[model samples]
Target: MGDCTAQCLHRRAPTEGGAIVEDFTIIHDEGILEVLWRPGIGIGPGELDVLANTITHFPRWHASPVLVHLNLVRHITPPARKMLVAYHHAGPIGLTGSDPVDRVLAAFIAQSRSRTRYFTESAEARAWLSLIGVTAGRPVPAPAR
Candidate 1:
């Protein structure tokens, strides 16, 4: 797994009504809906509810490719994971994060869900998304060595 910290992956500021919501940020860029998961949080039914609400509020995001950054997520509850497998749209999905568990989970999810790939670097994940016909945001170039 490549440890590429490219600026192309950015957390979108979450907003509801007017105030900023710190739970998570859903960014719609280049054709994919990039989900920037904040670290130390667990994905439970409540979290899944928030995700459902977000998607409902942004109906235009339905069926869009999903780029999930699980670096910040601590764990996915079994129920939440089951919900994800059931509700996640059948579309191109890319997951990149630092946790070994996350990578394993991603692989498990990919077994049933096609077009899913895990990477240590967001840039490489985005590139894979592009190859699968999902338009990804421009990746930030690595700094001069």
Candidate 2:
């Protein structure tokens, strides 16, 4: 299959009166999905729900690996953490973050899933995902652009 790339930004009002707005971007490249979470955003159940819906709507959601950027995330609510543990993605997941809190949160999620790993650098995470994809019988092609 030829290379395909798509990027979308999602915004949602976290509370009434349009006070707080949380946004995230999802980039689909090759056979992987990269989720870029906005800085200082508090991740709650609503945010996770939006993420779930966005992934479900992707064309290759079931088979595509995911690279999650969590370096800037402020915190994750308890409910959101629980939801993430239960969330199921068919392919491997690579989480990249540098902050201690980010690593801790990622560790929690990664520990609950066999195909998930945390990385301090995004390049490493992508490399891991590529390796996982190849070993899983799905060779991830390099980006065309």
Candidate 3:
């Protein structure tokens, strides 16, 4: 989740819920460019570890400016928030729910948006990501303030 020296790759994911059973790779196949894992609608350490390990392979996007769409997932834990805070460098981490982000995540959202030179789009997550730096077919680097 921190840093590595490879490019990440992933195929279309198929999931069943309790845990994510998605294939995550980095620079393995031909033009494996970028990997995007749309896990289930919730997150746990189990899933996070899988995600962390998967991205570690693609140091480019793992530590670079990435667009993580969380429009389908809402619930979050403090540890998860911390991991997002410390490890991932996202453009606009898509967030949507009825009030699930809680106090801690809200603060991290605010801080990551305000302090870390990141974007938190309430309207268009992917659009914001693209606005910052992410493109449809390229791995984006960290965005500056």
Pick the winner on TM-score between candidates 2 and 3: 2
The lowest-lDDT stretch of 10 consecutive residues in candidate 3 is 28-37
Off by over 4 Å in 2: 1-5, 12-22, 137-145
**For each candidate, how many residue pairs have backbone atoms clashing (under 3 Å)?**
1, 0, 1
Per-candidate Cα lDDT values, in order, are: 0.67, 0.79, 0.44
lDDT of 3 by residue, 28-89 (tens): 22212233334334555566677766655653543243444343455556776666556535
* Worst ten in a row by lDDT for model 1: 1-10
Higher-TM-score candidate among 1 and 3? Answer: 1
State candidate 1's TM-score: 0.69
Model 2, TM vs. native: 0.80
Using all chains and alpha carbons, the TM-scores for the candidates as numbered come to 0.69, 0.80, 0.44
Q: After superposition, how far is residue 61 of candidate 3 from its true place, in Å?
A: 2.3
lDDT tens per residue, model 2, 47-108: 88788777776777876889998888899998888888887677899999987898899977
lDDT order, best first, reads 2, 1, 3
Model 1, residue 139: distance off in Å is: 27
